[model samples]
Target: MNTGVVTGGWSYVWAAYSLTAGALFLYGVSLFVRVRRIVQ
Candidate 1:
C-alpha cells in the first residue's frame, strides 16, 4: 500500500525560500549602498 508520496514538507520548503529571498534582498541593499558611495 505504498505509493511513494511525500507529505508534510511545506515548512522546510518555506524556510529555504525565505532564506534565499532574504539573502538576495540583503545583497541588493549592499549593492545599492556601494553604488551610492561610488557616485558620491
Candidate 2:
C-alpha cells in the first residue's frame, strides 16, 4: 500500500531544493549587479 510513498516524497524533496536554488541564484545575480554599480 505504501509502494509509492518513497517516490512521492522524493519528488517533493527535489521540488523544494529546486525552488530554493532558484531563489538563491536570483539573489546572487542581484547582489552582483549592485556591486558592479558601486565599483563603476
Candidate 3:
C-alpha cells in the first residue's frame, strides 16, 4: 500500500529556515556596524 505521500521533512524545513534567518541577522548586524562607523 504505497500511497504517494511525503513525510518526515520537518528537519530540512527547519534547517533551511534557520540558515536563512541567521544570514539575514548577520547581514543586518554588519550593516549597522558600517553605518555607525560612517557616522563617527
Candidate 4:
C-alpha cells in the first residue's frame, strides 16, 4: 500500500528557510550601506 504524501518535506522546508534567511540578510546589509552613505 502507498503512504500519504508527506515525503521529501524536510528538504523543501530547509530550502525555503535558507532562501528566506539569505534574502533577509542581504536586505539588511543593503539597508546598512544606504544608511552609512546617507550619514556621510
Residue 40, candidate 1: alpha-carbon lDDT: 100
For each candidate, what is the lDDT?
0.98, 0.91, 0.97, 0.94
**Model 3 TM:** 0.81
Q: State the lDDT of candidate 1 residue by residue for 1-40, as single tens digits.
A: 7799888999999999999999999999999999999999
* Candidate order, lDDT descending: 1, 3, 4, 2
- Candidate 1 Cα outliers beyond 4 Å, as residue runs: 1-3
Weakest 10 consecutive residues, lDDT, candidate 4? 1-10
TM-score of the candidate numbered 4? 0.74
Q: Candidate 1 or 2, higher lDDT?
A: 1
Number of clashing residue pairs in every model? 0, 0, 0, 0
The C-alpha stretches of model 3 lying farther than 4 A from their native spots are 1-3
RMSD over all Cα atoms, model 2: 3.8
Instruction: Tell me the deviation in Å of residue 20 in model 3.
Output: 0.6
lDDT of 1: 0.98
Task: Report the Cα lDDT for residue 22, model 3.
Answer: 99
RMSD of 4: 3.5
Model 2 residue 40 distance off true place after TM-score fit, in angstroms: 1.0
